[model samples]
Target: MGREFIEIFEEWALDYDKSVMGEHPQYVDVFANYDAILNQVVQQSLGTVLEFGVGTGNLSNKLLNAGHNVIGIEPSEAMRNIASRKLPSMTILDGDFINYPYISVQIETIASTYAFHHLSDIEKEIAIKKFASVLPRKGRIVFGDTMFKTEADKQLEIEKALDKGFTDLADDLNREYYPTLDIMKNAFEKHHFDVSFKQMNDFVWVITADKK
Candidate 1:
């Protein structure tokens, strides 16, 4: 579970929308093309969507506007509240990637954005397996988050952030579970998902995994 960062999210909740809009200097690259990134995930989704880490409901709103029934799971109460305010009629539950409720309903696509890196590698593998168990054939896991092409590339990014005097960015890079593409690919493929990666910006990548 990525609940370790609940406190951080609680504090960041008020300013999250602004941060995503590129108001913050450090996170500009991290959230480049924010709307477009959410749109990409929205486009891939089908039928009912189970969204994990529904931070502030930005992606959730997109899904709902596209006419998909959206079930949101966010661990932070503050986040859940903001998302609820955004979409009042919808229910945004308290849960995470590895631990979330799925009512007796057909979930055709699972989606997340800017949040999966909170889970450790093992946790990610477990979450993917859980998705494999729940999603039907031709179902998808469309996630747009920060993923490095290689371990060396990840290190270079951290170093670049440090050189730019963005110690917080570097610290985030070191602290969280930002992994290489190879690792993510293995996790999904092992669980029988046909995965593809599309780099959205200098930082984020959209990973679309379809259940075989």
Candidate 2:
């Protein structure tokens, strides 16, 4: 399943930026807000920062422009290829977040966008624990993704898409999970992180957690 998803996303990566990255004004606004939120949460100049699922280095470029050393972990080779071509200075690693190899270098801040929802419940929990284990005492995590109001609502969207016969290449991509806000907050709390949430849109939520 994972391999299939990666293959689909790898193909999507070919035109992801031109097709989806800047196509939505709302998404751009949300990213701007998220960047401000991250600046405020870190409370000091950022040092070493790690971004999981840093597809195409869009946000990674923004972080670098803000004067931080950025390391990116991406699962899709196609995405990494785009990122490398776009931002050669970034240290990009190819691996899933659940099993990415990292050195003992302590990360002061971490951020992810539009990626956490792809993780399974157990995978999310383990990933949160792994992040906590490597972060310093005051480290922070900024995560945001598409969120559903309810299972019924999500089903309705799926049904609508299917009815429209919207058989895009993305339809072939495997999305293993879509966690509720409660589930995400609880998972972070379980790892000793103070959590807060903000609504970015009707279908998206931004969460920031700080290590306690």
Candidate 3:
């Protein structure tokens, strides 16, 4: 199922950058805040970092400029190809989170922005376990994505998005699994992660966890 979704994303890769990258008006500021949060998490200079779901190399470029050795794992070949072209110096892998190649490497930090919510609950749990298994002790995992405040809040947001042409009804239908922050925190905690969360905006939040 995940593989199928990746294939679809790969097929859409040509237009993905134009469609997704920096399309939102607040994207730059949002990412800037995320960079600040990430800077706080690393504390010192960073070592090797793995960016799961490095879509279009947008955040990848930022991480590279921050002096981190970054390996970006992206499921879509189209997206990977785009990232490779943009970030020729960095390593880009066309692989899924559940089956990436470099299991032996002890990653110091892992980051996924706006991508983790695509996973199902079961797959997310598996991926979290895998992340914990490969990370060094005290390694950090930073993830950011949208979270609904309540079922009513979600419905209202979807309605507003449709009315404002912010998103299509089809897109809203596909996004049936955007979990709340509390749910995400519990999931991470179950995998022995000491988690902290901050609401970044009306629709988005960031979660940073350290392997316990």
Candidate 4:
């Protein structure tokens, strides 16, 4: 469902890690507390994990280090190749949030970071329903992404970006499908997930949604 952004990620594969490392000026805040963010997600995750958008395998590496069985899903071939080379033993396949290969092992938790916004609100709901179908009761989804608490907060952030002469960042803010907290809460609740959100940085939040 989010395949339209695959080309952008494929082209950004080589530079993606650099950007996440706080080298990219516009994205420094976005990746702020990057290691901590991954750790938070990893800490909350349980058993086997299915990770979406394994860009450069940063979060995947963390999940692996935490001793969970990690099955990575990525839509960008270039990104997948990079992750494969980095973590040769992990099962990384070409896939996205709404579409992935069938796994023989049970998935206890679905995890992702900075990538869920690739889906629009409707697509997010669809994806949540798909995850509900895939998961048993008490199975969880731990995700971290850029989301605003309200529409006004989102607009204010966009204006602040523009005011700071961050045209590219503003463009990205407008371009990406970053959802408000209410929208995400509704999506998860509609599918019977007991969801909660925690701020990770100026721009990111960690979501722990346990299936009910």
Model 3 steric clash total: 0
Question: What digit string (tens of lDDT, one per residue) describes model 4 on residues 79-135?
Answer: 999999999999998889998899788999999999999899999999999999988
Which 10 consecutive positions of candidate 3 have the poorest summed lDDT?
23-32
Candidate 1 stretches with Cα past 4 Å from truth are none
lDDT (C-alpha, whole model) for all candidates: 0.93, 0.71, 0.71, 0.92
Clashes of each: 0, 0, 0, 0
Model 2 vs. true fold: TM: 0.81
Candidate 1 lDDT tens digits, 1-212: 89999999999999999999999898999999999999999999989999999989999998999999998899999999999998998878889998877568889999999899999999999999999989999999999999999989889989999999999899999999998999999999999999999999988999999999
TM-score of each: 0.98, 0.81, 0.82, 0.98
Supply candidate 2's per-residue lDDT for 70.
Answer: 84
Off by over 4 Å in 2: 1-4, 22-45, 159-175
Error of 2 at 166 (Å): 4.1
> Evaluated with lDDT, which candidate comes out highest?
1
| RMSD after CA superposition, every candidate | 0.7, 3.9, 3.4, 0.8
Cα misplacement distance, residue 208 of candidate 2 (Å)? 0.2
**Residue 108 displacement in candidate 1 (angstroms):** 0.4
